[model samples]
Target: MATVPSSSEVPPLAKYLASTDKKTRDKAIKQLAVVLSDPSQVTLPHSDMSKLWKGIFYCFWMSDKPLVQQALASELAEILLEIPSTSMTFDFLQGFWEATVREWSGIDRLRIDKYYMLVRRFVNASFRLLMRMDWEPSSCERYNSILAQRGGPLCSDDIRVPTSLAYHLADIYLEELDRALGISPEPSPSPAPLSTLLNPFFILAARTPTKITYDRIQSVLFEPLFTALTPKPDDQPPSRKKPRLSTPTYSNLIANACLSDPKAEGAVESEKLRKALLRRIFDVASGEDTRDANRRKMYNLWKSHMEDEDSSGQTAVDAS
Candidate 1:
């Protein structure tokens, strides 16, 4: 493995990181990960860390072809795992988010999909790092704070942060968590902090700079269910739409099942989290006066679901 240069020569490392030659770029990344994992060996100040991430951002930007991009994204995310210290892992995660946010608006249409993939891989990586720690409360709380707190990446008041990032984060939360924990429809014991897993969401709902972003985030989270309930323009008729909603689970099977089945085996803990998330959405929708048909339809569906459950004499999950 090629070694990193001395601290004084660090500035030029970005060239190596963004090299078209795979072998050169790969060595730079590995060496950078080693330095990050044990910073005492070669101290990198905050500014240098920021610059290195810029190189990494473009490293992905210059990545070739879909398969290569996919592999590179996974490799980049795995850096978080390589770090022996949790504190440095978060620093790296924060650096990644900062670099991405700074450049998000500049991403053009052609390259947008690749950046989206990059974000998804990072989110999954963050979850994997947490799961490795057994979802320790302080670690989860710290991670959530970094992502959703004021001035943080997802919930920052800065308009430059872009609503799409928050929307994407919301879109992937359940999917990635399920993926990270290997969750499936089959009954399995819930992980610890399972109930509080979504506390970041409520923080996001309250702190995100704009209502538009919040609505977008909320819409993405609930869209799977709403989409299942909704029919396409070319639908045959109302009769045919029943099959769509009853499809057991659409693309988001595990999450949809959690919403539809109150007594889902091994879902007691997950159910609490799901209900709280839905309650937040429902409460927000209730306050809006707009009668957009889809919003109205979604509201009614939730209302009916909650009412039926309430009348069934099932104990209500406190969504506080």
Candidate 2:
């Protein structure tokens, strides 16, 4: 029977790292530091190497192994920063972060906390990278390819990379790209109208007892909506026709806002706020000309309810 060769028999670089000799180990570490720090060399494909990429990723995610973890993190950061194209770099980092998140579940709480810091670092890095991408047809095609090939949208089996994170990352990527390119980030080809902006607050007031002054309503909600709704002049068609509103519909926005802040306090007030907001949304849906009629009917209904609530002195409604 043939005996397997000891690690000492391997090439000097590998042998030094795997060797027990202090001098050899130190030399290997220094060489690795150089290779890892060099972005071009690090990304070069080493097809014959067994699990080299996986091992690097493992070191990055395993914070319990402090020395290895720090080495990998430093190298990863350096490589990411050196990449010229923000989109490609961001996609790579996002994939890496997703893998790290999956690895996190089995880690101890203390280590998990440290890993969270790494996660934040990756997120911030991704955000910055996104700021540099061209959000044109080419970038969209690239994103669609990644989403389709990675099984990113429908799966969360891997904790390191959840579908929600992937989706949000894509959105942020596109949004930043649009901003950088001076284009509208919205999918619709048209720009939103001013009346569409005020629709939600109208609907919500009719549905609940919450009464938000226009100023508070604008501050809390409309500003963000307007930013997203308003399109760049260059994004409009060459014909100069009035562009249609392309902002997210009221219900979708409400749902997203609620889901975003699930633990927001003052549940009763929150519900009222949502309802008031929804009313404005309905007006938007109904069109500007019809908004007055809708508002009057809603106001009458709201007044009747307010009187009843005041008469009964009921602070909360019973669900059952």
Q: Each candidate's TM vs. the true structure?
A: 0.70, 0.35
Per-residue lDDT of model 2, residues 147-237, tens digit only? 3333332122323344333333323332332332233243321211112222223333223222233323433344444334333367554
RMSD, every candidate, angstroms: 7.4, 17.1
lDDT of 1 at 50: 81
TM-score of 2: 0.35
Off by over 4 Å in 2: 1-53, 61-75, 84-91, 94-98, 134-137, 140-320
lDDT of 1 by residue, 118-191 (tens): 98998888877876775666787788777765545666456667777777778777677657666433344235
Poorest 10 consecutive residues of model 1 by lDDT?
256-265
Task: Check candidate 1 and list the clashing pairs.
Answer: none
State candidate 1's TM-score.
0.70
**Lowest lDDT block of 10, candidate 2:** 189-198
Root-mean-square deviation of Cα positions for candidate 2 versus the true structure, in angstroms: 17.1
